[model samples]
Target: MSYRAVLRTPHALRTFLAALVGRLSYGVVFVSLTVAITVATGSYAVAGGAIALFGLGGVLVAPLRAGLVDRYGPRRVLPPLAVTYAGLLAGLAATTWRPGTPGWVLIVLAAVAGAAAPPLGPVMRAMWSQLLPDEAGRQRAFALDTVVEELLFVTGPLVAGLCIAAGAPAAGVALAAALVLTGTLAMVSSPVARAWPRVEAGAVVAVRVNRARLEPVLVASGLGLGLGALGLLIVAFATERDQTAAVAWIEAALAAGSAVGGIAYGARTWAASQRTQLALLVVALAGVLAVAGLAPGVAALAAAAALAGLFVAPTLTIAYLLADRSVPAAARTRAGTWVNTAFNAGSSGGSAAVGLLISRAPLPVCFAAAAIPLLLSAVLPALHERVDQQVEADPGAEHDDDRLEHLAGEAAG
Candidate 1:
């Protein structure tokens, strides 16, 4: 299916556009908050702490927020979360309006705002599963979504930069508040979102963490870890050569590669199962990253980075698709959220891990180390496929495995 077909899916354009508007706030808020807090308190340390707390708040509660949506539907849950999140952003803007605002106040407001932030991305992915029931259409939609989200992150910082240049850092925060609030309200107003059925309060089913489900999270986490380390490693590489300006161009190349790769992956149908595809993609990404560390110059490194990035979006899109397929419709949102949460957590951990390694080890060794996670993670899906093949070869074994899974689910519940 073409991208146009995905857009033409009934109500897809309106709902997706609205979600994009709200998701854009995510790209804007972090930069705005960091700059605003720094300007208010005149301390990068405090600004950094506030951003950390904000991220922690969001990550910690993401599953719970998604679970709420699973039970109550978006129309009933999204508005309140959006309103509270926007209100906190506005409050944060007010506090950061003038110099000498207490650092503690800014930190507290940011954390609360993040905690209240709506899970528009996860919810929208769930909606896509509903709107595009066909696998081909769903693949195209997810690719389009991932690519646009990448663009939003790139654009968001520029918007914040503009606000900063205008000498109104807090205005960026206020703008983010308006965007999310308005966009979420408009999204939920759509017939698809409004008609989303709510699960009964006690109707939640236990989703077993089998190989099918766990493999996606593992791969996603590994991919995030490798990419996260690559970001800082590239900067370090450039700094060592006194070519720091090249860092932006290298990062831009990576983004460009991902966008191109996503469009290409979605535009065609593949014969490989999602599992095999994910495993191969991760292996390719790992190999490219390892080779990137061997590049002798900034230009060569940028080319390798672009090559490594070609698999990034497709890997993530497949991970989400795996997650969506692992659970029933009612639990898909939470499942996808878990994959996302794993990726973000892995990214943060990767950055910290690489920071320590980069200082103590050779640059090439550090790059190889960064690729370790991806290499190890690629084993999971391959192993899962082997086990599935074994089960297929033995009918009694398959039956027993199903029974075991059922019992596990029961125990989990």
Candidate 2:
């Protein structure tokens, strides 16, 4: 095999390790911060409001920030961001005992912290494409990346719960922040991260509102909302059965299933077309809906939930890969921001919807409700592919479908 081939072969392992380090530290800190803020405020609503502020900052700035990554490269931007984030987290820790610290101050700190949120996930995805430099290698790299993200969250909350129980939530957050800074800095300095392509001057950049890049992003965002809803359902389902403590197990099973699916999909030599991936997504959605009908016990529900989650990481990884191939390098970060923003937005909506649904309807219905968007997402791939073909075949056919075609092409290169 050529040098590039060998390099790509090892990339999956390297990316997973690096991402694992980043995820463990950051995820733990995030959970700890949430717990700390909630305890200090003595109000779940206030805590949630604080979190909402952070999400808002992330959503508002993600596109602009992503553009910076595209301009400066991940290596250059990530280190400073990580360091600053750690410093801010430490500052929050220092002020944990100050009586009557205004809520708005906390909100501002949270927003700033969130705005500077680590670029590991997006930057790493971009690096995978660059490091692997082939369609197949890139695909596998994304698959593992998705799995790590899902898995890390499973550990993050458990660790945070322990720290909170021990009356040291701030310590946990500080530790998480320090580890994140250390891990990101270490990874960026490593040969793997440094091997990524440098940003060239005068690359064909496109940041203005382009319909071609917006539609699929919206769809991906919708998918995020659906996943968020699924999470809420899991929590509610467990709560309904008075197995609230088992929430961790539910999340773990879901993450495990997702990791397994991603590994299996990535290792396979026989690649599916984008269309096939979409079809499988539909199957996965069907499975999710089927979970609602499963027997109601922690074990059975967990098993069904895991099977349902098996499709999630792979599905998301494919979407990221498609967006990478479809968007221009100049617009890649913005495109990524669109997806991330969609996820955050969807998460907020899904959580709310699921909470309301659980109160008003059956638990199974909650699961089935989330499936609707998956079915829509499934249709998007074929429809997008057809639109892409049309745009390629006749570039000048000025039709709305042509606009949709342009968007599809932008999303699925």
Candidate 3:
């Protein structure tokens, strides 16, 4: 089915647009907060600390927040979180309006703001799962979602830059607050969000971590690790050649390639299972990334980056699809959140790990090292399938599995 068909699915356009508006705030808040904190405290160190805390708060609390959405439903849960988050952001902006705000205060506020940040992306994906039950339609929806999110991230910084150029960094924060609150309220007002049934608090069972469930999270982390390392690697590559300005063009090429790849991937229905597709895509991505280090010049490196980028969105979209299909409806949001958290955590770890190696190793070696995670993770899908086959081979295994799931659910309740 075409993307147009995906949009034509009842309530799809309304729900997706509302979610996008809220998600755009996520794109805007981090950079705005960093600049605002730095200007207020006059220390990049303080800014860095605040940003770290902000990320820590959001990442650490994400699964829990997603769980709440799963239990209580978005209609009941999202508004309060959005209100608290926006309020914190507004307060943070107010504090940064004047110089000499205590660094500790800024750090504390940012941490709380992040903790209160709504899980709009996961919630939206869950809604998509509900809205589009047909596999082909769902795939298109996810691809469109991923591509648009990529654009938002790219556009968000430019929006912040404009605010910064106007000498009102606080405006960006306030604007982010407005965007999130408005978008969330609008989203919840939609039939899709409102129609989502709240699982009784006692109805939820713990999510089972079978091979099928775990594979997507691992693959997502690997993808994030490679992409994260590539960012710094690109910068380092340009710096060594005394052509730092080329870094932006190279990154742009990567994003452009991803967007095109995502659209094309969604436009066609694949014959392979998501797991098989995921493995092949990761292998292709890893091979390209490894070859990227051998580029003869900036132009060649950009081309390699673009080639590697072709696999990114498709890989992630498949990972998310696998994640959604791995669990019961009540656990779907949490499952997707785990994938998101893994990717973010992997990105942070990749950047840190590569930072230690970049100065000590050749650029080619660093690139190869970065590709290692993707290469290793590419095997997980096959392993997952093997486990599935094993389970299916035992006739009594299905009953036992159901019992275990019931017991786990009771314990969770």
TM-score of each: 0.95, 0.85, 0.93
* Each candidate structure's count of clashing pairs: 0, 3, 1
1-413 in candidate 1: lDDT tens per residue? 89998999889999999999999999999899999999999999999999999999999999899988888899988999999999999999999999877888888888888898999988899999999888999899888888888889888988999999999999999999999999999999988887675676678767887777888899989988998999999999999999999999999899999998988998999998888999999999999998788899999998998887789989989999989988988887899899898999899999999999998999999999999999999877876665566677876665644644654566458
Residue-wise lDDT of candidate 3 within 279-309, one digit each (tens)? Answer: 8999999999888888988999999988888
Each prediction's whole-model lDDT (CA): 0.90, 0.70, 0.89
| Model 2: residue 41 alpha-carbon error in angstroms | 3.5
Question: What stretches of model 3 exceed 4 Å from their correct place?
Answer: 386-413
Error of 2 at 402 (Å): 3.4
Ranking by TM-score: 1, 3, 2
Candidate 3: pairs in clash: 205-409
Q: Candidate 1 regions off by >4 Å?
A: 398-413
Quote model 1's TM-score: 0.95
Alpha-carbon RMSD, each predicted model? 3.8, 4.4, 5.1
C-alpha displacement of 141 in model 1, angstroms?
1.0
Q: Model 2 segments beyond 4 Å from truth?
A: 1-16, 97-100, 191-204, 207-216, 290-294, 386-413
Model 2 C-alpha RMSD to native: 4.4
Once model 3 is optimally superposed onto the true structure by TM-score, how far is the C-alpha of residue 203 displaced, in angstroms? 2.2
lDDT of 2 by residue, 41-99 (tens): 66677667777877777778787778877777668878888888788778766555333
